[model samples]
Target: MSLLDVHRSIVVIIDLQGKLMDMIYRPNLVISSTIRLMKLADLFEVPVVITEQYPKGLGSTHPQVLSVYEKLTTKKFYMEKDSFGCCEDQFYSILKNARPDTNKQQIIIAGIEAHVCVMQTVIELQENGYEAHVCWECVSGRGEEYRDHALQRMNQKGAIITNHESVGFEWARDKNHPKFKEMSRLFREGQITS
Candidate 1:
C-alpha cells in the first residue's frame, strides 16, 4: 500500500518458458512488457530473480527475455522451480537473498500464466508480508477469462495491480532521479503487442 521504492524492490520474472509462453493469451504483450521491466530494473540498479518452471518440460525462458536478462549487470539469479508459487520453490530463501539489500521486500513480478503461477506467487508473497506489485500487461493466462479473473482476484486480496510504466516512474520517483531518459525510451518502445 505504498509507492514502490527502488531500494525496496526486486524484479521477479516468472515462468516465461517456451511451451508455456506460447500458450498464454497475449504472449507478445507479456514478452514486451517483461522486456521493458527487465531493462528498467537494470537501469535503476534493482536486483532481479528469474524462475523457470521445470525447464526440462517447459523449455527455458523465452529467447527475447533471456537476452535482456543476460545483459543485466545488476544483482541477478536464475532459478528453475517445480512449485507453481515461487515461495513454495526450494530456492525461495536464496531468491530472497539474491537482492543486494535483503530489505528489498517489494516484489515486482512480470511473467506468464496469470491464473496459476502469477496468482499464487502474489497471494503468497502478501501472506508472507511482502508487498507484491504485479505488472498487469506483463502477465497472462491461456485464456482471457482466466487471466482477467485472476488479476481481479489478486487485486481483491491486496496485491497492487499495476502496469510496467507505473513501476518505472514509481521507482524513479522524480524527473531528476537519473536514468529517466533510458526509462522513457523503454516505455516508448510500446508495452503492447500484436
Candidate 2:
C-alpha cells in the first residue's frame, strides 16, 4: 500500500537451487534479475533471506547467487528447508524478527519453480500478513504458462506483482537518499529494457 521503506523491507530469494535452475523458463533472466535485486539490497542496506529447498535433492543454491550473499556484509539470513512454503519451515521464525532494529513487513520475493515453491511461499506470506512483492523477472517455472498463472493467482490473492526495477526504485524512493546515486548506477548497468 506504501512505498518500500528501506527499514521495513527484506529481500527473500527462495529456492534457486542447482538442479532446478536450468529447468525454469528464462533461467538467465531470473538469475540476472535476482542478482541485480541482491545488489540493490546491499546498496540500500536492506536485509536478505536466502533459502535452499532440500539442497540435497534440488542440488543447492546456484554458486553465483550464493556467492553474492557470501561476499556481502549486508544483513542476511540463510536457511535450508524441506518445506515448499518458507513460512512452513520449522527453522524460519518470523520475517520481522530478522533484525532487532526493524519490524520488516514487505517481502520482495525471487526464486524458482514459480508454480510450486514460489507460489506457495507468496500465498502464505500474504496469509501471515506480510506484503509479498513478487519480482516477475526474478521468478520462473519450467513453462511460461505456469509462471504467468502462478503470478496471476498470487496477484488475485493480493500479492504485489512487481519487478526488480520497481523494487529498486521504490526502495531508493527519491534522488536524495544517501544511496540513490549508487542505486541508479546498479540499475543503469546492463539493465533490461522494460
Can you write out model 1's per-residue Cα lDDT over 1-194, one digit (the tens) per residue? 99998888889988999998777887888888888888889898888889999999889999999999999998888788888888875556755576535653888988878888999999998888889999989888899999899999999989999988999999998888778888887777743774
Q: Candidate 1, residue 113: CA error in Å?
A: 1.1
- Residue 74 of model 2 has an lDDT of 82
Instruction: Give the Å shift of residue 140 in candidate 1.
Output: 0.5
Model 1 — which ten-residue stretch has the worst lDDT?
95-104
- Per-residue CA lDDT of model 2 for 1-194, tens digit only, reads 67777788889999999999878898888888988999988887888899888988779888989888887678888888887878864424646456566554888999988999899999988887788899999999899999999999999999998988898889877889888888778877885632
Q: What's the true lDDT of residue 131 in model 1?
A: 90
lDDT of 2 at 100: 61
* lDDT of the candidates, in the order given: 0.86, 0.85
Q: Mind sharing the TM-score for model 2?
A: 0.93
lDDT of 2: 0.85
